[model samples]
Target: EDQVTQSPEALRLQEGESSSLNCSYTVSGLRGLFWYRQDPGKGPEFLFTLYSAGEEKEKERLKATLTKKESFLHITAPKPEDSATYLCAVQRGSNDYKLSFGAGTTVTVRA
Candidate 1:
């Protein structure tokens, strides 16, 4: 079965702290990896799309990278406004866009 798991469950980062969260997954066949940021009571905002192994994408203080069986989201100098849930999702193509997602890593960036 294809599944995703994120570590730390939660993270506390100082305004200038830089850290990375982990999302490990196992899929029958990997098609794509996606990274999204979701705020409380809001839909997820697309951040990056990784189509193959060794691919990466970035935005502002966020960077996303993908491997064969896992993906990572690195946050550099996170700010209070960056506090949100980081979600990782994967699609196997056999199914629809109902991406299977990790529980998410809740990050709180303190000012």
Candidate 2:
């Protein structure tokens, strides 16, 4: 069965600390993997899309990389403002715009 799972459901980081979040998934007929950042009370903001293994994407302090079975979101020198819930999702087969999202990793950066 196709599924997505994230570890360390919640994390607390001192300002300027760096960390990496994990997203493990298994899907049949894989299509794409996506990452998003969601602020409190707001919808998720698109971060990256990985189409194949060994693909990587970066924006600001966040870098996302994918492998055949999992993906990782690495946060570098995070600030307090970077606190948010990072989500991992996947689309398989002909799902079109549909995505299966993992539980998400909530990160808090405190000064």
Candidate 3:
């Protein structure tokens, strides 16, 4: 089974404060690691895809990087609008579309 674990289940940050979220995984045959941002009561929005170690992707203040056993989502100078639940998922070779997700890190950026 592919499993993912994210740290600091919840975060409270003042506006303009930056932080990083961690996603650690254990899988039999790793296919890809994915990062998503989900607002309250909404489906997750895709953020990045990491197929191999050392792969990185960025969008505005969000940057995602992957390694052999973990991935990191770095948020730089976040605002209240950037607050959301960040989810980390993993897909194994057996299933192309099925993703096992972590519990998610809920970020609260207060203005």
Candidate 4:
């Protein structure tokens, strides 16, 4: 079975606080790991795609890294607007676009 789970269902942080959110997953055959940020009432916006362990991608204050069994989304110096739900998805097998999404970690940054 393929599944994704995120820790700390909700995180409250002060402005400029740096923290990392965890995304633990178990997939049959890992093809690709995807990271996305979703705002309220909106769909997920793609952030990064990691194909192998030790691979990483970054954008602004957000950086994502993947491993054989899990992934982490590190946020550096987050601001109030950075508050949002971060989701992780995985695509297993060749040509498999079936995304298994996590419940997501809702982060709130207080400025």
Candidate 5:
């Protein structure tokens, strides 16, 4: 069984403040780790996919890093528009279509 836990269920930040969200997980056979951003009424938007430890990906003001036991989503100088629920999900194996997801960490950036 694969399990994911995201810390700091909710976050409040000033417009230019930067912070990192943590996603811890345990899986039998790790295939890939994924990061997503979801708004109030929309489906989750894909952000990054890390296939191995020490891997990283970046887009705009967000960066995603992967390790053997956890992943981190770093927000750099976030703006009000960056406010969203960040979700972390994991795939168990190479051919697995099912994903285990965390409850998500809701980030609110105030301008």
Candidate 6:
């Protein structure tokens, strides 16, 4: 079984403040780690996919990094628009269609 754990269920940030979110996991066969952003009452939006340790992806103010046991989402100088629920998921090597997800970290950025 694959398990994922995310820290600090909620976060509050001021506009332009930077912080990092953590996602830790343990799985039988690792395939890929995924990051997503979801707004209230909306579906999750794709952010990044990491296939191996040391892999990283970035877009605008967000950076996603992966390691053997964990992944991190770094937000740089986030704006109010960046406030959302950040989700972490894992795709097992055995199944390409199924993903195990963490509870997610909700961020609120105030201007």
lDDT value, residue 65 of candidate 3: 95
Tens digit per residue, CA lDDT, model 6, 1-111: 789999879999999999999999998788899999999999999999999999999999999999999999999999999999999999888845469999999999999
Q: Which ten residues in a row have the lowest lDDT in candidate 2?
A: 90-99
By lDDT, the better pick of 4 and 6 is 6
Kindly list the per-residue Cα lDDT of model 1 for residues 64-93, writing each as its tens digit. 988887888999989999999999988876
Candidate 2: residue 34 Cα off by (Å)? 0.4
Model 3 clash pairs are none
Model 6 bad stretches (over 4 Å): 95-97
Q: What does the lDDT come to for candidate 6?
A: 0.94
| Sequence-dependent TM-score of model 5 | 0.96
RMSD of candidate 6 to the truth, in angstroms, is 1.0
lDDT of each: 0.90, 0.93, 0.93, 0.92, 0.95, 0.94
Q: Candidate 5 on 6-43: residue-level lDDT in tens?
A: 98899999999999999999987888999999999999
lDDT of 2 at 100: 91
TM values, all candidates: 0.94, 0.94, 0.94, 0.95, 0.96, 0.96
Q: Which stretches in model 5 have alpha-carbon errors above 4 Å?
A: none
- Tens-digit lDDT track of model 3 for 1-111: 678999989999999999999999998778899999999989999988999999999999999999999999999999999999999999887746568999999999999
Whole-model alpha-carbon lDDT for candidate 4? 0.92
Quick one: best lDDT, which candidate?
A: 5
Kindly give the number of clashing pairs for every candidate.
0, 0, 0, 0, 0, 0
Clashing pairs in model 2, backbone N/Cα/C closer than 3 A: none
RMSD to truth, every model:
1.2, 1.2, 1.2, 1.1, 1.0, 1.0
Estimate, for each residue in 1-111, the C-alpha lDDT of model 4 and write its tens digit.
688999989999999989999999998788889988999999899989999999999999999998898999999999998999999999987565578999999999998
- Candidate 1 vs candidate 2, lDDT winner: 2
How high is the lDDT of residue 35 in model 2?
93
For model 1, where is the 10-residue window of minimal lDDT? 90-99
